[model samples]
Target: MDGVTGLDVHTLGIIGLAVGIAIALSFSLMSLVLRGMAALHVWAAAFWLLTFAGLAQGYDENGSFLSAIIGSVLIALANAAMLIGIAMHLGHPLRWRGPALVIVLFLLIQVGFMVWPPSQPLESAVFGLKSIFWDGWMVFFLLRAPRELKAGSLFTALVFVIDALFYVARGLVSLHPEMESPELASLLTTSNYLFGILCTFLLSTGFTLMLSQRLVHDLRVAANVDGLTGLLNRTALLKAAAPVLQANREHTHAVLLFDLDHFKAINDRWGHAGGDAVLQHFTRTLREGGIPARALLSRYGGEEFLLLAPCTSANVAVTLAESLRALVERSPAHYAGEPIMFTTSVGVATGTGTHIQRLIDTADAALYQAKRTGRDRVEAMVSDPSAGDRVNEATSAASALT
Candidate 1:
């Protein structure tokens, strides 16, 4: 009761809750630790939160001095366990020489402090050293807590630093047993401790928020992107194209469609491995050094890509279509050191708020005509056969992607 009188009941309750939470967290965090990608947060949180409680309880207990030292050793073990768990999850090798030494020394000091209480004037330096070492560990861990450097390890270190710095400051205050003004010293010391607690709270909360934000962003990008081809997936492409189509009410637009000619033959000749290499390589070319950062490029289907050229004229669309055709003809990818020749028939259609579906249908017809006329040729869509006015066309060339 005498020990409890000096401590704020609220802080005591918080410390209790933190320890209870840590016990609950072990069940949840252990499973994730076994998995490769988990944050390992549940255990880290509980471990650190309860650690403060243990330290406070140890100091408060009127029992033998060794209890506090044992408590410190237990907390250090939890930190060590967290580091190992994180390294396993990341598949990163651990080199714990420096940090391990700091932890071992910390345990030794805690035991020393219990064995030799601070009531004696000669014990001041020992208390100060222990406090300083605790602060040192905190700083070291904080420095290492980024994803590239073991984020979980860094966060856990920061929490310990907070706890350690608080003790060090308290130890420093105790060293000056007689100050200029006892009341003033007490006020300043209390403010510092309160602020340290706030900083610790911020470190935990801040990382939690940051991690959640990153996870959400990654999940969203994965859902909307084609994992294999790295383009806007089918659904995302349509969703993006829908808005562009609706806005082209006053201007004519073009759709240039291209399908890789003799693609299946390459798969048959080489192998599915060769086919995949070809697809990935050819898609890079189709991107034409990357869809105009502003333009939308999408994989419409196997060996088929759609480029939506907004408010583009037939002449411009034809030129771009031919560009794509020429690129594909020249960029014959190889697998197993064998050059794999491939080509695509391109179709282009220009329409102004007339029929978007017709735009694609007309291009499809032209694509078919190109394939029918010759395997490696471009053909324009003729809106009226009698007039022979080719609204979309491929240049007369043997090589499609020049």
Candidate 2:
């Protein structure tokens, strides 16, 4: 069969072989910089080696069974390397047993072929069965992967399934005498070779997309999460809170600012590492306590945190803030086999308007008041003159109590 520009099967194989080598080199370059990209590098190398083996056989048209047998062995190793690369990408523990066993089996198959050479049909059947089983195995891992990777994995798995079916069809065709005619056989072989190259291209594209998707996911997590406390950082908190503030303009929402009292003294006594331990302990306590899931807790700054709770009145906000204060005072952070007790001052402010910044400012003022009056206490300030007379009066009453 002549492809575009009258290219024969041998020419196509050479082209495929060239493309495989380029892909291998590209992956090799990437592996040097990107951690874990070595797996993909190995996959590309295996693919190229298999292509090299096929090209070798094509070049040696003479009855040198040795070249073909060597190609088969390379195919076995290539399959094993492909599996190893996939397992590494999926974050599975790399195991040597599977690839080792595949190598051993392929070596034995070579010996068996040399002893009593099987017919074309028998050889096709044996190879096809092994290919189908391994392809199925690859598909299994893809299907069982995480949801984030499902789309890409499934796309690649479909290619593997199609390749498996191709082998099965080839094996069946080899058994039929009519299909074995020189013309029909040549056409079938050319078609198989073309389809195999297409499958390789698709697989490579899918794998690249998988890596990109994971990189984006990881970057998002890194941007949003606080490295020290694992809470949402200040920037992320503000981004998340903006929508909630807009929607709850008419509803009551509370913003509580928490500052660890005398935190500088703790840092001075325990050093920075111990101070880090205390901060971690405080964040853990906030999570473990009955903090509502709907609320957003963020590390506001060095020793300060912010909790934004929607649909809560001034009275409820005060109660919640008082509970948090007590919880922190009770929880002691243990470091270096000694208990380090600490206390927090909380400032509570309720808002019935769309202005998040105003609420935050009011909460900060109350927090200042809490620290000024005394540490380890909760202070309320719901003073918003613009939010109608009733709201202002209610907030004024709460402020008066504080």
**Winning candidate number (TM-score):** 2
Worst 10 residues of 2 by lDDT: 386-395
lDDT of 2 at 305: 94
Structural similarity to truth (TM-score) of each candidate: 0.60, 0.78
How many steric clashes between backbone atoms does each model show? 9, 0
Best by lDDT: 2
Candidate 1 segments whose C-alpha is farther than 4 A from its true place = 6-212, 289-291, 354-356, 382-402
Clash total of candidate 2: 0
Q: Each candidate: what lDDT?
A: 0.61, 0.78
Candidate 2 runs further than 4 Å off = 1-10, 36-77, 87-119, 143-151, 247-249, 334-339, 383-402
> What local lDDT score does residue 185 receive in model 2, on the 0 to 100 scale?
61
